[model samples]
Target: MLASVTGKGVCLCTILWILDTKGVFSLKNVTLSIEPSVVQYRNTSKLRCTYDLEGDALYTVKWYRGSLEFYRYTPSEKERDKRKQAFPFKGVTIDVDRSDSTQVTLNDIDFVVSGEFCCEVTTEDSHIHALNNCKSMVVVQLPEHPPEISVRGEPFDYGDILRANCSSYRSRPPADLTLILNGITVNQTEPLALRKLRPTDYSDLQLELKLSDLHFQEGQLNLQCVAQVSSVYHETVGLELQSVRHPVPEKVSAPNTASAASTASSQTIPLRLFCFTMLCFNAESVIKILIKTIPASCVTYYTVVATPVCDYTDIRINSLDKFYALIVVINLINIKMPHNDNPK
Candidate 1:
């Protein structure tokens, strides 16, 4: 009886050890990796599942998109053609040629595919060990063009108010918009506005800046608008601001009455001429006086008189009365009577 009991106990311990070993070698470290977590619409993506099954064989590798099974891989299938399979699902197209138990290729993904994706693995063990991992993906419909920035109150002047607006349109998931002024971000005091159309969305942001001396300290203000959709898309538009300042008025002194009168008299004088003859007169002296007092256009002709004892000249003067008075004084001082050998 003692021998039989001891043998049975040994067998029981062996069975327990085998069970513990099997449990220890079950599935572990199951991880799911989805490339390009942010995917553009109608683009391809790849998902991979990695697991350490110890010494167990892979029973099935199944992929789920939000609780719906779309792909399955079973190595234990008797028929080779039935081992890998794909199910029809909206927005999910599997590339069967490049898919296997470890990884799956997704083609032509769209907005409907943006959600949690799970990978489940089961081992061919008596205990049917299973494990699953899930990750998220986002599909975005990018805008055809970058965000547009516009200013309402342009040609800004000091102490004026400036208004600006930024717009991003036609995106499935609306892009975020930011307004920056001179490299500094401008806070959005106004509420953001959204307009949704079929298959796309639009976003708009407004900003207001008060023009002051501080804003124009650097001579010009720089404004920018940035649009972003996660890490997939980014665009920027910028504008420059300058303030217009009016020029200061200059001072003017009162006019001089005496100078004004003199200028008026000179301009209003009537032009005229007078002829004079003198004895023992210098012809060159008379000619010089006439040229200074008369304009060249008014003078018709001039005659110089030469005598045995004196020289004289006939001069025509076309000038103001002040100039004629000056000529009479010169004649009195420069003329010398031909020494009257005969007294008259």
Candidate 2:
């Protein structure tokens, strides 16, 4: 039975459809529409169900969802049999309100249960019926962490190029290199350079820092260098800018050009200064002096350098060719020079 109507005709049809009692039942064109078809994580995704009925005899209607069911009766099921108004909606049902309603709600959603839902309605008019369908899906993603740094080398010394390099050694992805010197930090976009780590075959990453011009201090110098790579963790090793002490020449030898009469003076000055470099002798350190007079008299004096008094003079001007060094700090008085003949 197809009932098409305008304004007044629609009202009349509604009244007749509601008042019909003894007519044959033929349920057809039971079109259903649900509100939402998709959902989000932890959010409530549901649907609003609606339908279009065919004839007046299609009174008793039932709606079946996935596994649960519900029903609504016409002409007031108050007079109908108790067994006739049975609803498929019990404990595991949803949206059980309003006539011509067939909506279902998905509660407490996760990544597991994302699929389609059906809205099946049956008219108990001993004839035709209709239903509808809807579906939804949920997606998930993971998180990530930033990078870190580290360092390597034998040791550091004064005048040694304190070679310090920067590398993103241990990282999931190769790191973007950065450098932090003193108090300033270098960004990644700059033309950063990292020397190839020249470690032994069995070693890890290598970074170099060359810090020179170590001062003449008593204790260790406090210096440091760190490597900063984007994916590499932060690491630093205290560079103890060690003082590199060179070997000081031993006792000053006599002037090679000086003969028995003319004592060497100018040439012996440079030789004496060489002994001041670093004096470590006989398991201890001692300072030996090379004294020269302006009149061309040069002498090597082995005495307590602090005490000008000659203590135990080993060799000097007088002991020429008689010692291991061909020169000594002995008292060689009367050693005169050739006549210069300059008038005063």
Candidate 3:
């Protein structure tokens, strides 16, 4: 009879195992969702738990912050008031009216609330089945203002060294800092500097960028500093640097003496003097006298006199005395004109 009872018990256990393998009265796809996994202090956050109970009824759903239980939902409770209950836990504020079997709402969260959140679900069956899921949440105190960027070695120039520092004030998790030059990220080889302030848990972060042989585009360089705290807060500040250099002087050249003499000699006498000479002498006789008295190099003045008057005039010589007088005047004027001493 004992062997027969043992065989029956083994058969019952086998049947339960087969039922579980077929997903009958079992939990599947248990998930925990936390909105704003990284949350700012004094803000609200939501936590949701979801599960599929195949061919089973939910007995209880419980919420825990770390290992401490703060909320429970029992749909099978006979008293309607007892169906949802909240227990006290430090740093956990539950809005009971807005919470249900699948989700819980947290209000006015602070840094103390940062920890692992867990959800547990149990099935109502003679053979009880339970499932739980946990996820991490962080509550941070954000910096009050954006990051500040300070640059040293102003008036940058090519082949010069440039140094800059980016700083972010007190924050729960110190902000990450990056330096960008003209849309390209500049890697920081040095370790970041961290400082902790008194009377608070918040800390400060600072990064430095020291670049040599600085290059600029279009006579200017653009530098930016970005600070970020998780996914909740981000800020960027930028500055432009202009290159400076000294002015250059221009060269001056001396005047050419030969060119000045040539210009002065080419100056022509007045037309009235030509008209007066033409009235005193015939064109052919004046040409003969000019060729004999003046050098061949000075024939340009003869051409100037003959061109306008002799080409169109039929005037007859009235006096030889006036002709001789005009020749004397021409010789005296030619002597007064400037000439180059050194001929090339």
Candidate 4:
């Protein structure tokens, strides 16, 4: 009876081995992911391909770009030459020295490198080996220039529609734009593709915003235009408008009016001239000017209005919050043009 039981145990073990060879007991698992799924063209950045394997004797691991094999890792290979290749494809450089069974390294990635990357795994033994695959897409972006923000209609003024156009040019996969008023996102628009520029891989995004409802605090308004190309890439530009208040002149009696006018004329013109000089010194980018007469002040109060002409990218997050504060300051330069007989 004991001999019979031993024979039965051996038979059962054989059956289980046959089942494992036929893949009945296969429990192999493989997973893959790429670090920094996005890359900027012409920028020297590294990409890491990492994978995890469980429950299978790895025969060969392969990395492919859109069905084109670029890398292979073999854990069972004894020959170093058969382990990995530095340049599997022409002009395709893989850092084989840093690569191993679980991860591969790629350096100096460019626009041509964008594609779906897949990792494939196969077991050593054909009878029981499980085949698995995992894939992730990568995006290579062209260097994006700062978005250009221009006023669409009449220049910015209190209580009027502030229509402006914001555009970010020469970026891959276009950028989304947002218009902000005094720290609040007033409006957001989808990216509109512009005419393709040079380096055929890049595109532009243009968006327009019409701000009808704007809140002015202390006679000042702040506007910011933000562009986002990807989760890792974005930029902003800002502009501000301010209204200054000056004391009104006290009315003078008829007899003293002439004397007062003469004295006012002498003092007011120089003050206006000084104010004009100060305005020029304060802000260099004075793009627009609106001239008006203030009857209360006797001397003309020139609201030295300036419009934002350009946008520049600010990458530092610590400084981004203070971006609007640095918007060009508006200064009122009360300049009195000498009264001449000829209107011209």
Top candidate by TM-score: 1
How far off is residue 322 in model 2, in Å? 91
Question: Ranking under lDDT, best-scoring first?
Answer: 1, 3, 4, 2
TM-score of each: 0.62, 0.26, 0.61, 0.54
Off by over 4 Å in 4: 1-27, 43-55, 86-91, 126-128, 142-145, 152-158, 184-214, 217-219, 243-344
**Alpha-carbon lDDT, every model:** 0.74, 0.38, 0.70, 0.55
In model 2, the Cα lDDT at residue 119 comes to 53
lDDT by residue (tens digit), candidate 2, 1-344: 34544666889888778645322233334444433333333455455444555443334444444554444445445554442444533232233332333444545555444444455544545444445444343322111232233333324345554334433343221234444433333223232244343221111233344544433234344333343332223445443333444322468888655463234332222222222212122112223333433222423332323333323433333222334332333333232222345724
Which candidate, 1 or 3, has the higher lDDT? 1
lDDT of 3 by residue, 95-174 (tens): 88889999989888878889999999988765577899999999888788887777777776666667777777777677
Kindly give the stretch of ten consecutive residues in candidate 4 with the minimal lDDT sum: 271-280
Who is ahead in TM-score, 3 or 4?
A: 3
Name the lDDT value of residue 4 in candidate 4: 100
Better of 3 and 4 by lDDT: 3
- Per candidate, the number of residue pairs that clash is 0, 25, 0, 0
Q: Where in model 1 is the C-alpha error above 4 Å?
A: 1-17, 188-199, 245-344
Instruction: Please write out the lDDT profile of model 1 over residues 48-116, one tens digit for every residue.
Output: 999998888789999999989999999988775689999987986899889999999999997899999
Winner on lDDT between 2 and 4 is: 4
